[model samples]
Target chain A: MAETVDAGFLVRWLVAVAEAVDREADRLTELDSAIGDADHGANLKRGFASVTETLAKEPPASPGAVLVTAGRQLVSTVGGASGPLYGTLLRRAGKSLGEDGEVTRERLAEALDAGVAAVSQLGGARPGDKTMLDALVPGVEGLRSSYEAARAAAEEGALATVPLRARKGRASYLGGRSVGHQDPGATSSALLLAALADTARTEEA
Target chain B: MSPATGGAAAPVGIVLVSHSAAVAAAVADLARGLAGGGDLAPVLPAGGTPDGDLGTSSELIRRAAKAVDRGAGVALLVDLGSAVLTVKALLAEGDELPEGSRLVDAPFVEGAVAALVTASAGGDLDAVVAAASEAYAYRKE
Candidate 1:
């Protein structure tokens, strides 16, 4: 399990996320319309598109640089709370990774834990808050084992949000009305982790 | 810090953040207009996205904060939701905004007026912030 990921691998991972967001934007918006302001999908779509564009224009030199650049791009372009929250997540993770030329699975897991913590701190949210943390907390925990495990855990966490009343973000305004709908942020978080898992699997193959 | 000639302390600067570029600018103008005819303090507006859409942008806020920083601390007044969140993100980045900068929780329009009047009178950051926050208790009935 010592397979290492370089700058190129991180770029591929972000591109994968961009593609996934593009493919699922409508579904994400549908989820948001149920309990939120209905801009999560568009916001994420723009943010990832900028990430893809920025990476192509001038690729970063290391895994840390890659994540940092993508995170900053998201913060500047997303135009919503997701922008800063996701930006802080990737930026903190990149900072934790330092300027490593290649990152191992265990190292990436540790970095992701730091990233998730930053998100939680920025949002002041816990795992039961029906926010992205619902999926992200479990995803980082599972990453300590296998990529497949992490992906599965993230999906489960996202699905689990359907029954929880919102305690954070715009959705919280709806109170019990938010219970029946799947959390858009958690759902998007699952997509992001799934892309990470796919990228790791491809690298291993 | 006081001037070499022992003049009054530098007045605090003010910044307004909002989702719409026009709203931030309008609010800033309103504050300045109502601040009375004195050596007015710097009141800058940072609103909307780079695309000029209806959302806050750190870049715009960054530029506004920098432009209005005059050795005195900067006081930020923000509109609802994303405006506050985006400014908080910049503040958390540390070094993105000027030192002693703070986000004051107050009503958008009324707070801006109170803050600007206090700042123009050479009020320190604390006085400026208190004025804005105290605007909430003003009876409108």
Candidate 2:
């Protein structure tokens, strides 16, 4: 089994993400309605739609190019803070991949770490703040193990946000009311990592 | 472009980023009106999502920043949350903007007006950004 990812695998990963987000759009929106503007699902749906369209329009030659193009589309299409946060994630990760034809798992993990750092820097949100960083930080950390482990870690991290008070984004405006609700951003981030892990597993199989 | 060669061609530009399209355009209009509607600094509005919804678009900001950038540079003022994130992401994409372009963290309306007024007076990019940042200290009391 190959331990490396390629552009084709990345494309499939994005497709999986789009499909997962599409399926869970309503759930994500429901979560956001509690603490956010109730647009997380719709925003990501639109952004990922644009990404798929861009991918179909101009197929990227490299794995880095694929992620970069997807990031640009998300930044342009998605509304709210999630747009830039997700966009920066993929863009920074793509840049870290450099011009390599094949991406090693270690390289991908390193790139994801950089991407997670960029998200924290851009949003000023930390793990306990009940933002996407809650999931993303642990996801990146788990990448050091295996894709399945990363996926599970991301899910756990996202679930951990349920007990946290919001300290960032629109949710923060709710103060104490933000507790006891799962963060929509963290949930969506978990989905993203899940999609990546699924893709990796499928490719390896 | 350097501020040392200031002229009509090298005036500092201002960009207003907001979640609402109407808000951004209205603020730009208000700033322009305050500047007497003459050859004041170029004020561009990069507001809303690409679909005209309520959200910030980095692509739109990048376009507006490029359009308004003459030679001096651009000063960007954002409204809350994702607007700032979008701008930061755009900047982090490496060498996307011309030299000296910056994002000013201040009150959106007041900062836009102040930055525009300063730019209209031939202020450089740093000066325009400073004016916008200084608006944070302003109190209505």
Candidate 3:
């Protein structure tokens, strides 16, 4: 049977992302301390917390509404590049989802691709720049297959970011020192994708 | 402040978006001083995260941009990093600003002062944005 995504699914996915971000916040911050500000974990934690709370309070009627609300919360709550970047990702994707009652996996993939494109356009950082695009690009590509595959691709892309010289964000300020450090944005992005995959799996089970 | 001819508000308003709220406010103050410390134009500071920490907030930028807009339009001057991203995100999310508002890519401080001075003199939205953009090519030498 084909899997479908709904408003409830999006809400659960956001909750899973929040939980994952909370669990990995310390590690994310530590990674950022190497080449960028050491607030990646805390920032994401706070942003996702607000996202969950808003989701509960408003209870969007559609998947697009859920994603848009989550994105808005992130944009308002998170105090770093990650806020707008990730917020744009979800918001763009949500906009692309249209007003469909249930979204197919193919539609989800296409929307995710749009979201990743928005991140690239907003930040002007391509895959090799060692930003969130690193994980997001691959994650979108992996969506063509299975959620599990997308999760793996995102994790791999994030890991691949290590050893790349920073070319964007605060890490770029470090120049050569930015080399050999995994990008915090990419790491957190990967974690968020992984949470999405986990949510998919749980729903299927 | 005396209104313009026909009792209309200023032709242009200004918004300073920075990573630090204090920085945004300070720059607005400096720009206001350059505009003769009078209410020549509305200058709003939209900076920092919602919690008052360092970082840009798109929500804050949108609110400030709206607050300063007086039917003519608003000029947005942004600092480095996510301040630009936040504004871009705001645009991408379809949060429409008042008609004639624009984001000018110029040095934050210099562009703001130039834009403020021009707007204070009754320059239109396009002219104020031009002033800010022209600051990009300004040479210190």
Candidate with the greatest lDDT versus the true structure: 1
Question: Which segments of candidate 2 are over 4 A away from where they belong?
Answer: B5-9, B36-38
| TM-score of only chain B in every candidate structure | 0.92, 0.91, 0.87
Write down the TM-score for model 1. Answer: 0.92
Encode model 3's per-residue lDDT on A24-68: one tens digit a residue.
Answer: 999999999999889889989999999999999989988887888
> Over the stretch B64-130, how does candidate 3's per-residue lDDT look in tens digits?
8888877777788999887887776676656456655677888999999999998888887778888
| TM-score of each predicted structure versus truth | 0.92, 0.94, 0.94
Residue B62 of model 3, lDDT score = 77
Candidate 2 lDDT score at position A16:
92
DockQ of each: 0.65, 0.79, 0.72
The 10-residue segment of model 1 chain A with minimum total lDDT is A1-10
User: Given candidate 2, what's the lDDT at residue B38?
Assistant: 59
Ranking by TM-score: 2, 3, 1
Return whichever of 1 and 3 wins on TM-score. 3
Output the number of the DockQ-best candidate.
2
Candidate 3: CAPRI quality band:
medium
TM-score of the A chain in candidate 1: the value is 0.98
RMSD to the true structure for each prediction, in A, is 2.5, 1.8, 2.9
User: Model 1 chain B: which ten-residue window has the lowest total lDDT?
Assistant: B1-10
Answer with 1 or 2, whichever has the higher DockQ: 2
Pairs of residues at least 3 apart in sequence or in different chains that clash in candidate 2: none
